[model samples]
Target: MSELIIGVLGLQGAVSEHIKQIEATHCKGIIVKKPEQLHDIDGLILPGGESTTMRKLIDRYGFLEPLKQFSLQQKPIFGTCAGMVLVAKDLTDSDDVHLKLMDVRVKRNAFGRQKESFEATLQIKGFESPYTAVFIRAPYIETAGDQVAVLATYENKIVAAKQDHILVSAFHPELTSDTRFMKLFVDMVKKSKEIAAY
Candidate 1:
């Protein structure tokens, strides 16, 4: 298989950390600041950041439509932290939704404020063991549609899930050295590329 190229949305958030994790998966990581850059990558990551601010940047750069088109192309997309909020189809208290690519309803800052941030080991679905999840004013999935597969939960609140090529986690997986989560996305990209080639 050829080396996969993964782009991290660089509008705002933990861009560098996600880049590092993508590289750890033996894939080329590029910062996607423009909509055109989306065409050069096989997969994309929406890292953790302030959703409102990120949304402003995304709109400012004309990325909203292009991003939705990217997902429509069946290219793998992994959203973490505030990225989870970006991809969710519904918001608990607000009608404003960014990508609306994932079939989940999310509640922003469901975990509380910044001072309430902490880490916990999570037993994610399909993983052999627990994965350390870092939550910093994270959001949780209030409800998921039939197509969404719940991956992990904390305090009975959905924290991780996947639907086809779209994956989301409410915690900062890039903050940890563990590359399993990133690797999983890489594999998804590879499979997507393979299917496209055929």
Candidate 2:
């Protein structure tokens, strides 16, 4: 297989952390600040950051439409923390909705403020062992559509979900040393590229 190139939206967030994780997976990770950069990526990662700021930057940088087009093409998109909130169809915490590409409804900061942040081991579906998840003022999915597959939950709150090529998590996986989530996304990129090639 060819080396996969994944783009991390660099508007605002844990951009470099995600790039580090992607590189740890032996894939090329590039920071995308312009719409033209999106053309070269096999997949995209919207990292954890302030959703409102990210949303504003995305709009100011003319990324909203391109991102929607990318999602429409069914390429893999992994949204972490606030990124998850950005992609959701509904948000219980605020009226501002950005991407609306995912089939889930998220509640922003459902876990509380920064001081309330903590880490836990999550039993993600399809994984035999539990994965350590880091939640930093995170948001959990309040609801998922029938086509959405729940991946992990903490204290009965939905933390991870996947719908077709879109994946979301309320926690910051890049903050950990675990490469499982990054690998999963790389695999999704590979599979998406394969399907597009055919």
Candidate 3:
């Protein structure tokens, strides 16, 4: 099979880090700066960053509708940290939602400010061992729809989840050296491409 191409929303956040991880999985990673670039990738990674600022850039770059359409196509999306907030259908603190693609209610900065950032070992679902997770001004899922499968939690708060092609995590997987989290997303993309071929 040909190598999969994954894109990192380059408007903001850990774009290079995600690119590195995507390449680590033996896939091509591109920084998607325009709406039309979405058509070239089999999957996308919304990296960690300031959700509000990223939203502004998304609108400025005219990516809002294209991003929504990308999700509608059932191409896999992995949202990390602020990216998770962007994809959520609802926010505990605000009525405004960006993508509204994921069926979850998220609370921004649920873990406190940047100085409060810390790391924790998480027992993610489907993984055989604990994964070290880094949380920096993160958001946690307060509620998820029936279709959402809760993947992992920290302090009893939902930190990771998957609903069909949308995968999200409150922590930044790119911050850690472990590629397991990224591998999971890669697998999701592989499965999606396989299904689309038929």
Off by over 4 Å in 3: none
The ten-residue window of minimal lDDT in model 3 covers 109-118
RMSD of each: 1.0, 1.0, 1.0
Candidate structures ordered by TM-score, highest first: 3, 1, 2
Error of 1 at 82 (Å): 0.7
Give lDDT tens digits, candidate 2, residues 41-109.
999999999999998899899999999999998999999998999899998867788899988889988
The candidate that wins on lDDT is 3
The residue-level lDDT of candidate 2 at 3 comes to 79
> Which sequence of candidate numbers ranks them by lDDT, best first?
3, 1, 2
TM-score of 1: 0.98
Evaluate model 2: give its lDDT.
0.92
Candidate 3: tens digits of C-alpha lDDT, residues 45-80:
998999999999999999999999999999999999
The local distance difference test score of each candidate is 0.93, 0.92, 0.95
